[model samples]
Target: MNILVTGGNGQLGSELKHIAFQYPQLNCMFTDVEELDITNQDDIISYVEEHNVGLIINCAAYTAVDKAESDIERARIINATAVKNLIKACELSSAKLIHISTDYVFNGEAFCPLKESDQVIPLGVYGLTKLEGEQYVVSSNEEGIIIRTSWLYSSFGNNFVKTMMRLGVERESLGVIFDQVGTPTYAADLAGAIMSIINSNEKLDKKGKVYHYSNEGVASWYDFALAIFELSGIKCIVNPIEASEYPTPAKRPYYSVLNKKKIKNDFNISIPYWRDSLRSCLYEIEKSN
Candidate 1:
């Protein structure tokens, strides 16, 4: 099977590129915006048809949360319009799509783990646009999968894990939000899960389905910071503070922890605990340094 991974230079996509060699049966093509403009429908169709791509894993996204608040048009184009283009291309080429989404689809009002079936009420331009992308995939009748993940980090790119690791050594004290809580996902682990789903014989019944995937366990941003410091042996002190203490252009979901029951049962894959995955990612970072 031929697989085309968009946003190939991103955190998740880079991890996929690293592991693609392990799956010799599948021909995986990785492309970034410079190589493939997902916002252009013609480009997507021509590339997929030319490559005979059986599946597309769209990791391309406008993920600058705060910037999206001011950059509405760009975000809409990338998060919403571009997704529709991918969906249409999939329809034309009879290719399956696995579109990645975000936990910001929720309003942060719920205190429990968010489920795939939960009501969505996005709070900011970023969330609203991301939700729009999800709607495009869900409304399509073609074979598509929407996987919503939270607090994603990886050693390959700029993410929370790298940020904390850097700031911890450079600063004496850091303040992190304690009120907001969710699971931290290692992109490497999620990449493995995506590959597993593609290689498995599990059928989707020709309908679009949404699944939640994240590392097990949960923690607030403060806790996540502390772990990074501890694991990396950084002397920085992380202080816990309320969300109100630190404000941003985009309003983040306070409790975006996702429920992974559906994905766990359907795919029969075991997820690593958040700390364990963090340790693995830290190890990767250390090796590179």
Candidate 2:
């Protein structure tokens, strides 16, 4: 099978690139925006035709939450319009699409873990646009799987883990939000889950479906930071504070822990706890540096 992954340079995309080698049956083509502009329908069509792509793993997205407030047009273009284009391309090529979505789609009002069928009430432009992308994929009436994830981090790119690591070394103290509760997903684990879905191929029959995935267990930004520092052995004081204490342009969901029962049962996979994955990621970062 020929698999084409967009946003190849992103955290999850990069992890997919590294692990793609393990799946010898899959011929994976990794393409960032430079290689394949998802916003351009022509580019996608040409690439799909040329490569005989069987599956499209769309990881490309406009992910700047705060900046999206003022940059709605740009965010919508990439998050919504670009996703429509990819769906169209998949439709034309008869290829399966596995699109990554976010937990921000919820308003963070629910005290319990959010399920796949939960109502979405996005609090900001970024979440709204991402939810729009998810709607586009589902409405396309094409073979697709939409995976909603939260608090994703990895050894690649600029994520919370990397930021915390850098601050731990450079600063004496750091303040992180304690009120916001969610799971910290390791990108490698997400990538592994995606690969597992592809390998199983059973879920493909249930296309146009949505599933929630993340590392098992929940933690606040403050707790996640503490874990990172502990795993990395960085001596820095992490101050836990409320969300209102650290204001931003975008209003984040206070609680967005996604339930993994559906994906776990459907794929028959065990998810690692957030702290364990954090430890593994920190070790990888340490070895790289």
Candidate 3:
């Protein structure tokens, strides 16, 4: 099978690139904005036709949460409009679409872990645009898979893990938000899950299905920062602070923990604990540094 991965320079895409060698039966083409403009339906159709691409894993997204508040047009273009184009291209080219989404679709009022059947009430521009993107895929009646994840980090890119690691060395102490909570998803693990789904053939492919995936455990930003320092052996002091202490343009969900029962049952794959995955990623970073 031939697979095309969009946003190949991003964290999850990079991790997928690293593990591509594991799946010898599959041929993968990884493309960033330089190689392909997904917003251009003609380009995507031509590329898919030329390459005989069977599947598309769209990792491309407008991820600057706070910036989306001011740059709504650009966010909608990438998150919503581009997705619509991709789904159209998939329809024309007979290719399956695997669109990556976020946990921000929820309003964070739920006391329990969020399920796919839960109602969506996005609070900010980023979430709203992402929800729009998901809606396009769902409404298309296409064989598309949407995996909504939370708090993603990886050694391959700039993320909260890398930020905390850098600040741990540069500063004596720092304040982190204790009120907001979610599980940290390592891109490598998510990549592995995607690969497992791909290799499973018809078993894992559900028509217009949305699934939730992340590491097993949950943590606040403060707990995540402390874990980063502890695992990396950094002597940085992390002080817990409320969300109100530091305001941002984007209003984050207080609790975005996802329910992984469907994905786990359908795919039958194991997910590591958040801290354990963080430790593995930190080791990878250490090796690279």
TM-score of each: 0.98, 0.98, 0.98
Q: Order of all candidates by lDDT, from best down to worst?
A: 1, 3, 2
Off by over 4 Å in 1: 205-208
Tens digits of per-residue lDDT, candidate 1, 19-45, equal 999999999999999999999999999
Error of 3 at 11 (Å): 0.6
Q: Could you give me the TM-score of model 2 versus the true structure?
A: 0.98
For candidate 3, the TM-score is: 0.98
- Give lDDT tens digits, candidate 3, residues 1-289: 8999999999999999999999999999999988998877888888988999889999999999999999999999999999988887788888998999999999989888999999999999999999999999888866878999999999998999999988999999999999998899999999999999988775324633799999998899999999999999999999999999999999999999999988888888899999999999999999999
For each candidate in turn, give its C-alpha RMSD to the true structure in angstroms. 1.0, 1.0, 1.0
Number of clashing residue pairs, candidate 3 = 0
lDDT of 2 by residue, 1-289 (tens): 8989999999999999989889999999999999999999999988987899999999999999999999999999999999988888888899999999999999999999999998999999999999999999888878888999999898999999899888899999999999999999999999999999999978464633899999999899999999988888999999999989988999999999999898888889899998989888988888888
lDDT for position 151 in model 1: 94
